[model samples]
Target: MTTKIRMTTPLVEMDGDEMTRIIWKMLKQTLIEPYVDLRTEYYDLGLEHRNETNDEVTVAAAHATRRLGVAVKCATVTPNAQRVEEYKLKEMWKSPNGTIRAILDGTVFRVPILVDCIEPFVRTWKKPITLARHAYGDIYRDVEMYIPGKGRAELVFTDGKGGETRLVVHDFEGSGVLLGMHNLDESIANFARACFRFALDMRQDLWFSTKDTISKKYDHRFKDIFAEIFESEYREKFEASRIEYFYTLIDDAVARAVRSEGGFIWACKNYDGDVMSDMVASAFGSLAMMSSVLVSPDGKYEYEAAHGTVTRHYYEHLKGNPTSTNPMATLFAWTGALRKRGELDGLADLAAFADRLERSSLRTIEEGVMTRDLGILSTHPSKKIVGSEEFLREIRLRLEKSGEAGRSCR
Candidate 1:
């Protein structure tokens, strides 16, 4: 008897740049292709290709993801001034992620790589705590002006039907900060829905935090909206799933997060997500190990490596030097997206394959077979550091051998 392999849905693949890009190709060749019969729609989204296509490639990729319901992406360059000069880019293009998020209107969830040997900065985090950031219309997109004269500062909100105004501040006596910004009810509603969806998907408790006490009317509105939505829509599902929705002050949430053991979904405002993600990344380990997923409110998804292009190491690799680049995050991008795709299509075998791959990667690390980043943290520091090719080859060998010997069977 022979086992049959099948794919219920296609996965959109956006290839990217630098060290992880190299890892991306290697991963598909080794781990994914060998196990599953994947129907992948490939788009070369490397910087050069992006420039050649005038960044239309990214837009198309996002559309494909929306249609297909799942996308696995490599970490691409969000080119800045330095990158513009280095790559001789025609224009300083926007981040591919930003472009995709705008199209999908999604929230980005970042979760760290938790290895037993690599101790987290926040010692209490035994499990990975996922952070879902509402990636729209807050500090990221704000209108501000400095008040030179002592007049007044008002946040005048106007609707199409009528206008209602609120004096955000009055008597600006001293030279201080003044800003006017707002979130649309539509956007906030989508964000709340995404958070609820993510928590339900992960079967984890959802935590929301805000400075609602201080920003009573503004931030409080967000709090109230989330609460209302949760109560009206998500309460029953959350309870049924044996998960909970928690709201708290930002400071208190931070304190609780540090003290408590991990394994919860933290729904954050834009600014908080940006800041806390870095903290979470650092606590977990190196940025190279973090996995990120952009999940739209409508259930469309794109998963990717969370770190930037390792330019420093890329230069060495360009010189034909053996670099110990970690491919774990990139690998997870494929697995995570595929797992979601499986769930979406009700393909249990495909989902199980992803689970197996994830376990294999983690087991490889736990067994002291890792790249330089993780090898450095080994209890026996004398462990040999492996190059990119060597490390991946070793991982492949281990995965294959484990399957053959049925090591995990017992």
Candidate 2:
């Protein structure tokens, strides 16, 4: 047997739940362990374990990523009321991804894994569009109140100097609802820098959108920060890279995105990002085809799939049925982590192996061997749907055939 590639530092591996957890193992065993001397600081972020540890494991994993510089995570269940009963948890745990994002203070960048057989639904989209989502404060951290009867509501702030500022929110006629949302200036600055740096790194034009005219103060603040940072910090750098930085209203941006050939980074606020990311993923292909990476301001990275744990698929598997679940996003998550790890540790062979594995996986699909989700979307003339494990095995066959050179771990 040929040797496996080595790693200088261990990756923080966050295990997940449901069908994705099952596929995570299959990935390492079939596609990765065979080629690399896999080393990871494993943390079980699975629902049951999160329940047991009170989700402290998620926090530890995020800290580990900060220390180690890279991590690969699987999709975990963020329990609702139904899930709390199903898992029989003490309390509903917060989202593991959310915990990690807060600790790392990162921006999530999601890009579609394009393929020859599966073209984007949008006819003008010939290239992949990257979504640089600000992963902090907005509606996600909102405060709300359900007004039971007619009353006045106001926005009040007490400054550090003990001075008062106030604004009338609304005077309710009867029953109504109210929401308050905010973002910090520091966080906004960090988000802008992350987006600008990512755009420069990819050498792609950066497009930022917000309903500034409508939002006035709130959304305009985001626009101002991005513009301020761009003019003072990134203008020359962007000009040197020969890339443009454009800002438009959200509505106009959407129209431009649909009409233009896609190849740029779109910076969005928390809520807009959450909604538009799904829209972008669906337009390009399946959400399962999107690859997401959370990049911290300090350069820490956590790569994960944008999809959720396939609960329905897990139920089928529990019944001992062979299911054809797509593993592209999960597979790419590992490859993304590996490639980043190798780059940081100066392991060219390890990095090359990651690159090889990704090409092989994509090649397998292009050649018509894929899981059911992709098979349905694939327009390839000779497409064949395979079970989850078989889909990976097919990619493994290609990876080995590519003659990736690695040193023996034994």
Residue 80 displacement (Å), model 2? 2.3
Clashes in predicted model 1: 0
- Which candidate leads in TM-score? 2
- Candidate 2 lDDT over residue span 36-136, tens digit each: 89999999999999988988899999999999999999999989999999999999787788778878887999999998888788999999999999888
Q: Give the Å shift of residue 3 in candidate 1.
A: 9.0
RMSD of 2: 4.0
Candidate 1 wrong stretches, greater than 4 Å = 1-8, 139-182, 200-203, 213-218, 236-243, 380-382, 404-410
Candidate 2, number of clashes: 0
Compared with the true structure, what per-residue lDDT tens digits does model 1 show for residues 76-99?
998989989988999988878777
CA shift at 232, candidate 1, in angstroms? Answer: 2.2
**How good is model 1 by TM-score?**
0.84
Q: Candidate 1 at residue 389, lDDT?
A: 76
